[model samples]
Structures are given as structure tokens and as C-alpha cells.
Target: MDSSGAGAGAASPNPKCCVSLSAFYNNTIVPCPNCSCNCKGLPGAKCHSEENAGSMLQMPHDPLQEPEDLVRCTDHMCPIRVHWHVKQNYKAYWRVKITVTNLNMVRNYSDWSLVVQHPNLQSVQQIFSFNFQPLKIHGFLNDTGMFWGVRYYNEILMQSGVDGNVQTEMLLSKNTSLFTLHEGWAFPRKISFNGDHCVMPPPDDYPRVPNSSTASKLSLPVLVFISLLPIIIFVGPSHFLDYL
Candidate 1:
């Protein structure tokens, strides 16, 4: 074990460098604010692109020494990012998909797990691919959940590359009092990976369910009524019904 905690519970020194992104099932996207880590323009910063992953794997690793951060090249420059997507709405439930991406080209994460806090998690119907356990937050139903990859599968989050990600989908029953997809209600209230505090985008920047969608739903009854009127009024007229 590294006395400095290199591979043990390692977290981002600068939270600003680990911004996460989120999207809606419709693919509406949002990004974090402009805050960034000091590594960008400093004299001695190190980074690796997807192409150099082979060489990075060959470098010496010393647990006793402080390890270098060989993060992948990205526009946000985050070493890891968790993407949450609200996938669909059903009559009694909604679906979401979460993806954990590794942007650090130098290291892989072992025995990684995710902790998520959301009100609907208390009523989770099913979770796919990942193993799940509910964690209590207030001595009540565990709205906070611990998720990890299935054994001999994705438990080891790979280094950045074509195979550097793990993903899972969840179905949660709607809470009559709290469930609402509008105003970013679908986004998790809190999220963490490997015990590291993650940076989240501003709530204002979260994806919103457009007002028009609500309006369209409201008008559906009228549309159905209108469509049925001609059939009711003309059912008795065989000549007019023949055109239908």
C-alpha cells in the first residue's frame, strides 16, 4: 500500500478537473461551468492521449512514491466522468442509464463502486448488469444505493480506451409525491465513485423537460374526443361511413 495513498482511496486533488456530464434520453446535453484545474497551463503538467496508452502501461509504478496523473486528453480534462441519462418514461416507472468512464490513461480502477442518492431509488424496480445494494441514509428506506460491477466482469474499471467504461440501466417506480421528470428531477441528487467526491454541473444547466411536451399530453384527450365525434355522428349513415 502506498503511504501517500496512491492507489488506496485515491481521489482528485482538484475537483474542478473532474467535471461530469449528463444527458436526457432525447440527447439534450449540459456541461459544467468554466472552472478548471491549475494543471492546464502550469509549467510541469502531464497528460496522455488515447494513442499513448500502450507506453503508459509500460512505465514504472512505485507505491511508496507519489504517482503521476496520466489523464486522457479531453476538452474538459477530467480523469473520470459519470454520465447519467434519463432513458424513458413508462406508465408506472422510468428508466435511467449511467455510464462511468475512465479518462486516466495510466491506471485502472479495481473493485470500483458507485454510490447514488435519489429519492426514487427507494422504489427501484430492477437494476441490470451491475450488482446493487441499498444503503440507508436516514435510518429509513435506503434511497442511497451502492452499485458495483458483476464479478469476473466489469468490476475492474479499465483505463481510458475503447474498453475503458462500464454501464448499467435501472428502472425505478415513480413516487407520487416526488417523482417528476421536469426541472431535472430525473437527475440524481448526489453521486460519488470510489468514495471520491464528484463534481456536478449546475442545477440550472440540467436538462429540462420541455413545456410543449406537457401541453401536448394535456391536449391528447381533446384530440381523442374530436376524432371520435365524426364516428358517433355518422355511425347511422352507411353512405358516409363507407368512406371510412
Candidate 2:
């Protein structure tokens, strides 16, 4: 959770592979003087000229896969905890609950915001809160193949918490009809509160009531096994002997 590696003006370790947000948003393409493929348009355009191929920037790598960029803060002294929950998950839609708690004994946060990032999020359908009005919400894609959603709210009182419930819908990328959700789907890979990354404690650290569906699925198998156990014990040996 060393955040020194992440900052607004942080330098890119690999300049050739990384594009600045300013350059990308302005559609400024720095083409290799010797290459033929223009870097001025969409991402991943190839350089047809063999001479310039080596100099052209290769396709941008997935930022999530990079360890140094995906670092999570382990520091717990910040007195705030951000909890993310996937309330409902579907093939193309999902709902999320993000709870921000001020764990400080005597301090209150006048204004705060949560920042979350994903790769395939389409849009945030709704943001609900019981006590506060939504101040601002922004969603945008950058050159790093990551989409970011930032939400702002005002007034979280001392020793209290607030919940931002968001419903979002997603769509597949072009030429792809399906994607797997087993790997961190509909979950924020990175979370920050008021510009500081918060500790993401493990799920086991929190107590949760069992879901009804899960309980029913488990109970049905146990009930069937219990009902058949006596029959198996009383009838198995006799039936085997008769068959023999």
C-alpha cells in the first residue's frame, strides 16, 4: 500500500508504452518519424512501415495486470474504511453498495468522495443515498484501458457512516458476446476515499448472514441424504444378498 508510486504528476516508468492523459484526451498522436501507421486516431492502430514498426509504441498493456500500478494501501491509521459489496449480479447488469465509515472517535468529514475503476462498465444507472444528495458523479475512460467512476458527497458526521448504492449496466465489447464474472467482475479493483486509498480488509474479517438461496441449496441435499440414510442401512444388505 505504498502510495508514493501513485500521484497526479507521477512519471511513467515506461514512457514509450504509456500515454499521458493530456496527450490522449486531446487526441495528440506522437508518431514515429520513420513509421508509416498514423498514431493519430483510435488505439492499437498498427504501423505498416517495417522501418518504423520497431519505434512505434506497441499496444498498451492492461493496467490491472501491472503490480506496481495496482498496489493497495495497507495502512489503517487513516480512520476511514471503505466497504464494497456486490448486491446483485446478472449477466449484463449489476448493483453495488459502497459504504464509507469514519472510524475516528471525534472527527467528522465535511465532504468526501469515492473513486472506483473498472474496464467494462457501461454506465451508472442510479446512485441512492438516504441522508445526502449526490454532489457529483463522473465516468470516463482513459488511455490505460480502464474506466473510472468518481462519486462525491457532503457531510459524513463523526462516528457515523454513509452508503452509496449504485446500479450499473454493462455491455460486451465489440465482437464479444460474453464475458466471465468469476474474476473481480462488478467489483472495484481500486478504492479511494477523499483522495486516500483505504484498507480493504478481507471478506472473512466481516460477519455476514447466509444468503437464502445458498441456505436452501445446502439444506435440500442434506434433507434428501437424511431421508434416504435409514433405507440404505436397513435394505442394502438384504437386497444385495437376494440379488446374489
Question: Judged by lDDT, which candidate is best?
Answer: 1
Our model 2 lands, by Cα RMSD against the true structure, at 19.4
Q: Distance (Å) between predicted and true CA of 68, model 1?
A: 2.3
What would the per-residue lDDT of candidate 1 be over residues 1-244, giving only the tens digit for each residue?
A: 2132223266656562233445554455765444333245456455666676677668888865655767765556666688888887887888888888887776677777788888788888899989999999769767798998898898887877789899999999886666677776778877777777667778887886666654566677788667767876767555655655
Consecutive 10-residue window with the lowest summed lDDT within model 2 = 16-25
Model 1 alpha-carbon drift over 4 Å, by segment: 1-13, 16-26, 32-39, 43-45, 52-67, 176-178, 213-244
Q: Could you say which candidate leads in TM-score? A: 1
lDDT of 2 at 208: 34
Candidate 2 Cα deviation (angstroms), residue 24: 38
Cα deviation at 231, candidate 1, in Å, is 22
Position 171, candidate 2: lDDT: 29
> Given candidate 2, what's the lDDT at residue 41?
32
Cα lDDT of candidate 2 equals 0.36
